[model samples]
Target chain A: MVNVLIDGLKERISNAIKINQSIGIILPASNYPDLVQALFERINSTPEEAWVYVTVTKPCDNILSQFEFLKDSKNIKFVDCISRAAGINKANDNCIFVESPTMLEKIGLEIINIFKEVDENVKKYLVIDSLTNLIIYNDPDIVTEFFYHIINRTRTKNIHTISLAIEEEELDKYLTRLIYLNDKILKVRDSFI
Target chain B: MPITELSKNELCDTGIEELDVMLGGGIPTGSTVLVVGSSGSGKTTLCMQYLINGAKKGERGVFFTITEPLFKLTKNMEGFEFYDKKLIESGMVNLIDLRIISERLGLDTEKYTVEDASALLDILRDIADELNVKRLVIDSITALCYRLQTPEMIRDFIFKLGSSLAAMKCTTLLTSEVPPRKFQYSQYGIEEFISDGIMFLGDIERKGDLIRTFQLVKMRGAAHSRTKSAMSISTKNGVELAPLLKSRE
Candidate 1:
C-alpha cells in the first residue's frame, strides 16, 4: 500500500506535490488555512491539467476564494461536490452541498452518491476537504468503514480520491489503514507562526 | 505541597531510562497520567512500556484494549523486545480486551452493558482491584469519549476514573488521540485538567527529518522533566524516550 509520513510545513506542501494525489492534512482546527494553502500550491505546481473539486462543510471562507484563483489557472477545472439535494439527485451540477463537522456521515454518503452519478468512462479525482471533521463528527468505526467504501469505489471505477484529516492521538492507526488502501498518501505537519 | 504516606518510590518504571529519570524515577504512585498524541504517534507503545515495566518488577499490570483483538495486539508488539509474553501468561500483565467486552455487549451478554458508563466503570474497577493492579492502562479514553459524546460526560467520567484509581492507590495511564495542532491547548482540552498528569508524544518533522518527541505537560504533586525529549519505537525497544532536551529542534 501507501507509505505516509507527517512532514514539516515546508516539506508538507512539497510532499503533496511529489505524491501528486489527494492529500489529507492533519493539524489543529486553526491550521485549516495552512493546509488548504499547501494543497492549493501543490495543485498549482503541476504543468499537467487537473480537475480540482473543493468541497467544504462550512460556509465560504478564504479557501473558497483560493478556489476562484485556481479557476483561472491553466488546465484546472474546479467542482463543488457538496450537495443541496433533497433526496438523492446525483445528476444535479449547481445543486451543491457544503461539508461541516456536523454533517460528516451525511455528506460522506452524498459524496459517495455523487461518485456513483459520474460517468464511468470519465477519469475523475476526488479530494475530501478533510478526514478530521469526519473523525470529529463520526465514530472511527463509521469513518473507517466509510473510507473503505470510498476506496473500494475509487479503485473499481478508476476514480482517485484524496482525503485529509488532522492527526489526533489514537486515530493515526486507523488513518494509516485508510491511506494504505490508496494509491499514494501525503501527510502535512505545520510549525505555528 | 503537603506530604502523603505514599511516596514516589512506589511507582512503576516506564522502561525508558531517560524518561524514568525525568519522571523522578517513575510516575507518582496512585496517580493518573493522560498520554495524548496524534495518530501513530506511539501512545499505545508508551502504555505498553509502562505496563511491561511494572510486570517486570513483580507488580500487576492491566491493559484495557478498545479497538484491537488480543492476537493483533500481541502480534503488533511481538517485534518489540520488551513485550514479555511470559508475563502476560503468568498474569502479571493482563489484557481486559474491550473488543471482547464490546462484542459480548453486542450479543446482549449480561457481563457488559453498552448502555451505561457506570457498568463499564464498575467492571473495570473490579478487574483492577481483583488483580491488585499496580499499574492500569486504558488503551484509549477516545473510544469511550466517542460513544459518550459530551464534554461534560467525559469530564465527569475522567475525574471519576482518576479518583477511583487514586482510591485504589494504583497508578494509571490513559491514552487519548488528540490532533497535535487542534487540541494542543489541553490535548482534548479539559482532560489535562481532570487527570493527575498529562504526557504528550508528538511526531514532528524538522528540516526533512521525522522526529518523535515527548514531554510531561502537567503533574499534580510530582517533580518531572519539563524538557521536550526525543523518543522512538523499534523491534528492539518498544517505546524509548530520551533525556529531556532544552528545546525542540
Candidate 2:
C-alpha cells in the first residue's frame, strides 16, 4: 500500500490529517475528479478510520464510479444530495439521499445521524466534496452559516473535515469567509509534478 | 414531520386550464406549491385565481395576506372577471389580514424567534379549522422570512407550517419573491427545497420585446411538463398560458 502522506501533491493534506487538523482545499475545477480519487485513496490506506463523504456537485454513483477500487469498503458512507435533485432515485447501502443541496437543515441532520450510528471506537472524518456547487444553489450567508455549524459540530466530535472549492480569480466573498473559519487553507496547483 | 403524500390521480385544479395542462393535470392534493417570480410577474394573480376557482367549486378557500392588506388585495382583484365579493360575504372565501397582526405584535422584524413563528401558525390553524378551509394561499412568504433571523429558523417555520397544513389536508400556494440574478428562484433558496412543487414565472426577452413565461421546475410526486410556456395576464382572464415560443414558431 502506498503511503499517501509520504510525498507529492496530496502530501500537505495527508500531513494535516495525520496531525488531526481540519483544512479547506481550494483547487481548479478541472482537477476536482482526480483530486477526489487521490483523497479517497489516502482514506483507504487507513482501515481503522471511518469516512462520511458529502457530495454536493456530483451524483454519488458518479463519484463512486471513479473510485471503483474502494467500492466495497465498509468504512465509507455517503450523503448524496445531488441524485434526488436530478430526479434519479437509485439507492445504495450506507447512503443517505437528501432532496436537494438547498436543504441545509436536512443535510446537517443527516450528517449528525450518520455520525451517531457509526461505532464510537472508530475515528471519523467528514469530507464535503465542494463548496462551489453549494454557493450556486443557496444564499452565500446561509451557506456560510451551515459551514460554521458543521465545522463546530465535527470539532466537538473530534472529526476532521476537508471542504473543497474551485479556485476562482474573481474571488468569492463567501469562500473567503469559509477560509477564515477553517484551521488552514491549502491551495492545490494544476500540475502536481 | 413528513409531508402529505398524494397519488398520481389525486389532483387539484389550479383554476386556469392552460396552467393546469402545463402542470400535467393539476397540482397534487395536500401539496405545498411555491409560486416564485420577480416583481410584477403575476405571482399574486395566479394565487388569487387558484383560490377563486376553488371557491367556485364549493371548496372553502382562505387567503392570508402577509405583504398586502386584505382590502387592497380585494380591490385589485375587482378588475378580474372571476372576482366575487359574495363568496367572501358568505364565508365561502375568507381573507385573513396578517399584516395588521404582524404590525400589532411589534416584534423585531429582523430577529424573530421560533416561538413567534409558532404563534403565527397557531393563528392560521385556528382560522383554517374554523372555516374548514380546503385551499390556502399565503401571499409572499418572502416577507415572512424577512422577519426571521437565520436560515434554520426560516426553514423550521416552513416545515412546521407545511406539516400543519398537510395534517389539515389543505392544498397551499405560497408566493415568493425571486431575488434578482441568475439561479435565484426564491428569497432564501430554502423555499423551493421545502416545497412539494415549484412554478417559476419570469419575463423572457423575445423579438426585442419581453414575454411573460411560466416554467415548472419540479413537482415531487407528479410528472410535469418541463417546457417554458408563454403567459399573459389581463382583467378578463387572470392568467393565460400558451405553447412554448419555439414550438409555436
Candidate 3:
C-alpha cells in the first residue's frame, strides 16, 4: 500500500514535470510528526530547490527548533510567515495570530509569485501547512478566491504545491477540490503501523 | 427512498452503529455532536471513522485538525483502512490543519485582540461549501478554549459555533480533551450545553494494563449505550472497539 501511494506520487510529480509546469496538491492525513517527515522525504528526493510553507494552528515547539531539523538540507529556504510579517508590519516577534484577510491575500499571492520566478526545472514545491486555518478567520469564498490566484500563477510558473491538512476537520474537500483542478493530486492517509 | 426536505433534527446520524441503535436511528442529520474525552481517547479516531464512513456512502467529509501537524497525523493514521490518499486529493475526503491559521494570524501579545468566532466559523463553512462537505469534525476544542481569556467569551464562542454549524445543515463532531475524574461539565460548560450531543472517552487502570473505554454520556434527543465499552487500537484501524461489558440485566 505504501508502495502504491509512493508510485502514484512519483508518477504525478514526474508527469507534471514532463507535461506543462502544473500545480499539484498533496493531502496527507497522518499524525503530525509523520506527515511532516513524509513531506521532508519527498522534498529531499526532489533534485530542485523547493519552497516549503509551514502553517501552524496552535503553538508547537519553537519554529526555530523545527527549522533546525531541516538545517542540514541546503536546497530549502525558510520564511517565517509569522515572524516575517511581524517584522514587515513592525509588530513584535512575540505576536502570533492568524493573518488578517488582507494579509492572507497578500502573502498567499506573494508565495505564488515566488514560485513563478524559479526555473522550471527547479521543481519548486510550495507547502502550505494548512488551508483550514487560513480560511478559518476569513470567508471560505474569499480563501477559495485567494487560492485561485495562487493556483493560476503557479500553473504559469510550472511549480508544484503540497498542502498538509489534518483529516478530522472535514475541510479536506475544499483543499482536495483545488488539487483536483490541478494536474496532479496526492492524498496520504494514516499509517498501518 | 429518495427523500428531501429533512429538518435539522431529522438529519443526524451519530455515525456510531451502537449509539445509533440506542437512539431511534442515528443522530439527526445536520446536527452537531460534541465528543469530549481526555487525550489518547478515540475522539480523533471516532471522528475520522465518521467522516470516512460518510465518504464511503458518498457523503463528503472534511477533517479539521488543530492539535497536531497534518503530516504527522496522516502518518499516525496510515494503518487505518480509510486513510486513502486519493480520496483526500480528489476532494472526497479532505483534511484542514488549523496550525497554519494560527501562524498566519500572527500571535502578538501586544496586539492581542479577541478572536472572532463567527469569522472562524465562516472559514469552515467556506471550505464546507467548496468541498460540498456533508460531514465535518474538529478534532479537539481545547485550542478554541485556550484562545479566549474568559469563560463567558468561550460560552459566546460555543453558542456561535453551534448556530453556524446548524445553519449549514452539516452533521458535525467537535472533540475536547478532559482530564480523568473531572466533571462532565468542563471549564467551558457552555460547549456541553450548547452542543446537540456529548460523548465521553476515558481510561481506567486494571491489573496494571491501561484499559480504554468510551461511553455516550449525553445525546440530546437520542439514546446511547450507558455501559462502558472497551476500546483498542491497531495498525490497520488506528482505533477499534470491542465490547468489554454488555448490559447486565
How does residue A162 of candidate 2 score in lDDT?
A: 90
Least well predicted 10-residue stretch by lDDT in candidate 1 chain B:
B106-115
Clashing pairs in 2: none
Runs in model 1 lying further than 4 Å from the true structure: A1-193, B1-8, B105-115, B183-188, B243-249
Give the better candidate number (2 or 3) by TM-score.
2
What is every candidate's alpha-carbon RMSD to the true fold? 19.2, 20.0, 21.5
Judged by DockQ cut-offs, the docking class of candidate 2 is incorrect
Model 1 residue B205 CA deviation in Å: 2.3
Of the two candidates 1 and 2, the one with more favorable lDDT, higher being better, is 2
Q: Residue A48 in model 3: shift from native, Å?
A: 56
lDDT of 2: 0.78
Alpha-carbon TM-score of each model against the true structure: 0.52, 0.52, 0.50
Per residue, candidate 1 scores C-alpha lDDT tens digits across B1-249 of 454434557755677776777766677787788898877889888788888988898888999987667788888877788888999999999988875665555633223233466667777888888888889998887766666656777677767766676777778888888875444724346666657888888754432334567878877666765777656565554665543222223
lDDT of 3 by residue, B26-51 (tens): 77677777887777777887888777
Q: On a 0 to 1 DockQ scale, where is model 3?
A: 0.01
> Interface RMSD, candidate 2?
16.0
